[model samples]
Target: MEQVPGGPERQSSTSGLPSCYRHPGVETGISCTRCERPICPQCMVSASVGFHCPECVRGGSGSGHSASASRPRTVAGGSVAADPRLITKILIGINLAVFIAVQVVGNRLLDDLALVGRWPPAPFPATQGVAEGEWYRLLTSVFLHQQFWHIGFNMLSLWWIGAPLEAALGRARYIALYLLSGLAGSALTYLVASPTQASLGASGAVFGLLGATAVLLRRLNYDMRPVIALLVINLIFTFTFSGIAWQAHIGGLVAGIAIAIAMIHAPRERRVLVQYGACALVLVATVGMVVARTAMLT
Candidate 1:
């Protein structure tokens, strides 16, 4: 019934200190790295790299932190290590695995598993028609790729951009951007591509990552010209390259740019919500455009 003046009730056998030095009645077995004091679970605060004790946190030992951990020590570095961007790497792995399975296992299996587009099938059963079925493709087609090169390029880009972006934004926001961007890309493709032509890839979502990066860099007061140049070069290449889905690229770019702007410019705590809402609006607009265009075409 007696509470320690400043410590938690629970005592750590290792330290013999109450869980938290501040709340002696509360039990916190974790110790602070800076102060080396036992911390109650409630009082424990997470650093970018590790957990910190309440005293260390109050004294600001872990504030304004940069990643001191090396690559292998980074969150994705080891099996046991905690990387803030682990989800990004896992997503890349899954995509790569899918690509390998498709190439090695053959298109027959892929077709069976492929995300179907809105268009009805042409004379060929494998080539489904894209009449009204475009809505389904918005979500599914991102997982499907036309060739090894297609998936390979997208996955590589995802790894290059997704990891850092996820690290900066955190897992939930990164995943939201990716999915929304992919959907936006597909929706754009449906809007512009001939209903008779079926297309699939993750380019749109990857572009969204680029957009997110642009926003992040700007928020950090980094130069935007380099990013703009990179985007321009890629867009030019898309136009020149055969079989590249320019519509998807443009769609993703626009969506990503919009999301990034909302995220970077919005109030600090509201950035994530604004970014998410912007992407959702873009998707809805893209779908509406696709539907309207399809009706006009028919």
Candidate 2:
């Protein structure tokens, strides 16, 4: 083969010699780097070691590792991704879609999508916004935002926190933390909020993820001053803001911390079951609180 600057390799044909492996009709003076069989320039694949046949390149299993050199294999569910930030991007997309929807529907969207604490469940309070059985509000409310700035801030928080936290916790655990944190926030709201009020936004989940990130960073022995400072500022804002739901923030933070602790401290042998069980306990506690509150209201 002859070499040229910025051009396809050209092959010098030999009379009555072995032809290209891929194109038999085409005669050439090239050979497979490993098998040594005659080949055409078109079939030659450039490798760090040497030029190889297309078959060897695809199989990655020929002589001198020409065949065996392939891409790294990734496991099914863990650490198997070209881009680790996929879940974070998807979550941001969902949040943006929900925000647009809420704006399109106006007050009706707020009434239906936001979480409202319901009490005196008989005919559902006339003053209550959504119907009595709309339990999904506990989750959907986390994605609903009233104003452009509200969504812009919450989405920004989620974008920052979700990437790191998801990287540390893995997709499944990260999703669990997000959803349960939202539920914890909504449940705490149900326990403390008046039936006349409606609550919405992703602050609870964002705070929960921040708490988880802090814990993970601490576990890794990384300095947590930035995270700690952010937490303190958010806490101060929660308390100082007029309409902020400090209860939801506190509830989500506590629940996230609890779950993160359980997952981190769990033994390797029992980690999966223990992490899931810890999450179940949090959910159960939230449910029990809501039920108890309902009974008291009744």
Candidate 3:
């Protein structure tokens, strides 16, 4: 088969002088904003600034590259759309799946995953609930829920808070803030709740998103009155409700604030590292708290 010297072996439907940088067979006039290399539509990612090839996008993310921050993100889902809010959707899905599994498996799944404040046997406690050496409950409990109303309310709040926050912070930071906040909540529950208490739900993570949005709003010079009102109302409800883990709510809010502080203030040159460092510190602190609590219990 004969080939075009600088282009495809077969004539491409795309009309352009140069072929895609990676796909020599596909002709395209579109060039990457960063590297200025020609790219076909399929090879290009839409960025805040302009179109970019996958390689340039990857290269731009770190190593002090400025252009990468605006790169259109393709996340875990199939296609990344404008305002995808992919992380938020994923979190909701996982929670809903676990909720359904609870109905099917008869709360058995929660036994292994829910946060329990005590180390040993507590009658009527979920059989596999957190005990000594079951450290993973600190994070896993965020997904377990028994009541339909409980999961529904939490998922609604997550949809409201997470969509915008995920869009604003992007997927990675948003996820970090959420999971770390959940860990902080679990650690606090371990420290403060009755030894027999068993807690489960995504409230901790949802509160984390609220706190992050509050911080972001404050940092951006937006009026914080609404956020304050929301927090106050939520706290009131937390106190009013029986069986609610207010400790988790408070812990998650504080952790979220701490993480968002680093995210909102991080310098563009070191944003990823600074944000990740802040999250790591939160995780470390939560672990330290857990260890101290365990020592006291033992």
Candidate 4:
């Protein structure tokens, strides 16, 4: 029998699974996005699009140098940043600023920004809502919170879940995911919630981050118990609590899981296309839902 170079005999197992290049006995479904070499979770360094083996990440010395070794990327194919949590910090700052503005300006700012399917209730003129073309509210409401405890809890969750996600997905992708998740939440609320009832808060986006964290951890083959417990508890709380917009929680979570799956599992061959395309699709769905709900309300 002739030995083949860089062939099945060197990289695959008799069980029909590809063996990790560095650990021949270990089978892995993941491969280095740069080199396409099988890599177990232990050897799977997160790349901008997928996982990478240690060799590709380290690059070669002299004439064998590789691009990745010079400019490393995140699991979503985004350039690695010096401060991994920079995006998270910016997001928290924006939320805090809005919270402060609301506190200073009072219900006027809140009324102007809150997600209301309809405004002024039944007896008054229906002047404010997504139905009235107040589309900015879908996004603005995501950062609006009236209570200290609400903003406090939300910002804490944002730091806890979003910082790691930013490091994994990069600034651009992380912010996109956060915004889309928030929009999805608002769209769902508009679609199903009472037209006169108003909703505002960052919980929708925070829940989205929580869902993304769970997906990322699962992809890395990490212990799932902790995230699962947290998700279950939050879901229970969302349903049991009064004045909570449960629709937003469910919508953002579903969107987060869908987007994260695309970001983590997209083939390296077409990573950018698949990842952004999935995001575009989610955005389209969100817009469609909002449009449909607006039409119904108006």
Best-fitting candidate, scored by lDDT: 4
Per-residue lDDT of 1-298 in model 4, one digit per residue for the tens?
0000112233777767788776688665677777777776445566555667656777742225474655566766677676878988988999899989988998889889888888767788899888888999889899888888888988999998898788778788898889989889988998988887788888888888889889988977656888999999999989887778899998899899889888877888898899999999999999999989888877
Residue-level lDDT for 200 in candidate 2: 84
Model 2 C-alpha lDDT per residue in residues 180-273, reported as the tens digit of each score? 8878987887787775467788888888888887886675455578899999999998988677877789888988888887765565566678
C-alpha lDDT of candidate 3 relative to the true structure: 0.72
Report the lDDT tens digits of candidate 1 across residue range 122-155: 4554334334443565665676665666677877
**Candidate 2 segments whose C-alpha is farther than 4 A from its true place:** 1-80, 119-131
Q: Per the 3 Å backbone cut-off, how many clashing residue pairs does candidate 2 have?
A: 5
Listing every candidate in turn, what is its Cα RMSD in Å to the true structure after a full C-alpha superposition? 15.2, 16.8, 14.3, 11.5
Q: What is the lDDT of residue 187 in candidate 1?
A: 68
| Steric clash pairs (candidate 3) | 111-128
Q: By lDDT, highest first, what's the ranking?
A: 4, 3, 2, 1
Q: Over 4 Å off in model 4, which ranges?
A: 1-70
TM-scores for every candidate against the unseen true structure: 0.66, 0.71, 0.71, 0.81
Once model 3 is optimally superposed onto the true structure by TM-score, how far is the C-alpha of residue 51 displaced, in angstroms? 18
Candidate 1 vs candidate 2: which has greater lDDT?
A: 2
